[model samples]
Target chain A: MAKNYTKISIETSNDLKPKDETIDFLLNYSKALSVLKSAKVEFELVLN
Target chain B: MQEELITDATLVSSYIKGNESALEILIKRHKQKIYSFIYSKVYDKDVAEDIFQDTFIKVIRTLKKGNYNEEGKFLPWVMRISHNLVIDFFRKNNRLPKFDNSGEFSIFSVLSDTSLNAENSIIKEQVEYDVRRLVDELPEDQKEVLLMRIYNDMSFKEISDKTGVSINTALGRMRYALINLRKIIDKHNIVLTN
Candidate 1:
């Protein structure tokens, strides 16, 4: 594999203060919207 | 997911009353997991996107027809639909589903079970590494079956249809794959006792 991240997990999201797995999850959730937006932009560019 | 629109059950209630924004908000909220679940299944970036869209279309149709029974498990319900569509995509294509990269669906997320014991973190990492290593070396048939059953959580029936195999054969493949995996673990002498 290109990355050995299978072995190392830095626990970036888990902390004593707070973390946003939920927000991170939402960012992922917004992926479809971003994809739709980009495809629309590309189509508009092509039309223009 | 409806992170914004689903401030509470009230929004879903409004959604049930025929609100478009509520539906869109809900979709945007859980889009990533739905997409990842499908992408993980079919192992195609493009197909994942297509199935993701279709899933929402089904959701829209379901909602419009007032067929949404509010069980409060919105994302899981949506994910189930996305999962089925991805499997259907695999069925139509007549090809074994392969992970786009052995590492494409990174173990980080899968291993991100928040309850991971810090003391056993190293051991956990080692086990994960070894498991992944063995999984990588598995034959294409075994690897795809393992991924679908374990990762995608698809039922055996779903797997049979997706892989174009009979149900008995699908079960048999999984059984043999596990047997082979056990041999590999024994050969390595890596002890992970439950």
Candidate 2:
């Protein structure tokens, strides 16, 4: 006789909350965008 | 002399042959995106600038040593080097993200007693759940690009190289991901922030 196996899987998204990692990423991304914008201006200035 | 028409590979080859201006033109051509990529990870202007300069220095050294092999994909190659350097910086500084598994670790846990009401906490938690679920609903390719762009701070070019797709395809996936996410948000009336 073949052995029987039972498998159970649980999916949980209800417990999700804003992670510090995501928050930090957003903050960093915003700052980086500003820095890049300023750098572009400075680069243009030097080129001119 | 149509200098602007020179390709990255040509500029790199010329630089390798001791034409210093070729390297300058190469740097000038790709510095903005490269700098932006670095800034996305470091988040500090001074630090990003330092890494940006260091990335070029390393690139120059590698090119001089005849180590850089990706001729046509010079920008993507350099961006990979920049990404590695950012990782190294984080490793050296011990600044990598950490997850606290303790039950007490939560956004609400940091709030004052007066502000830690159940209603507000539930709303915050729901918004986070909805946002994550929406992201999960995205197609695999789009989700991959979205996560890489957001979490890994990788540029589209880097995403393309990593995912083995054209840059345009990677960018298109990201665009579609955003559009789909927006549609989901609107359909669910998901409020992302208070």
DockQ of each: 0.02, 0.02
Docking quality (DockQ) of candidate 2: 0.02
* Stretches of candidate 1 exceeding 4 Å from the true structure: A1-48, B1-8, B97-194
**Candidate 2: stretches off by over 4 Å:** A1-48, B70-72, B99-113, B116-194
Per-model CA lDDT versus the true structure: 0.65, 0.71
Tens digit of lDDT per residue, candidate 2, span B1-194? 57789988988888777777777667666766776777767767667776776677677666765667963499888989899999988989766554554444555556547764888899889877877788899999899999999879999889999999999999999999999999988988877984
TM-score per prediction, in order, is: 0.39, 0.42
Candidate 1 residues B1-194, lDDT tens each?
Answer: 33653463565566667554566566555656566666557666666667766776666556544567787577778878887877687788756635454744554655556775876787888877878888877888888898899989999999999999998988988988899899888888967742
Ten consecutive residues with minimal summed lDDT in candidate 2 chain B?
B97-106
Flag clash pairs in model 2: none
Question: For model 1 chain B, where is the 10-residue window of minimal lDDT?
Answer: B1-10
Chain A agreement with the truth for model 2, given as TM-score: 0.36
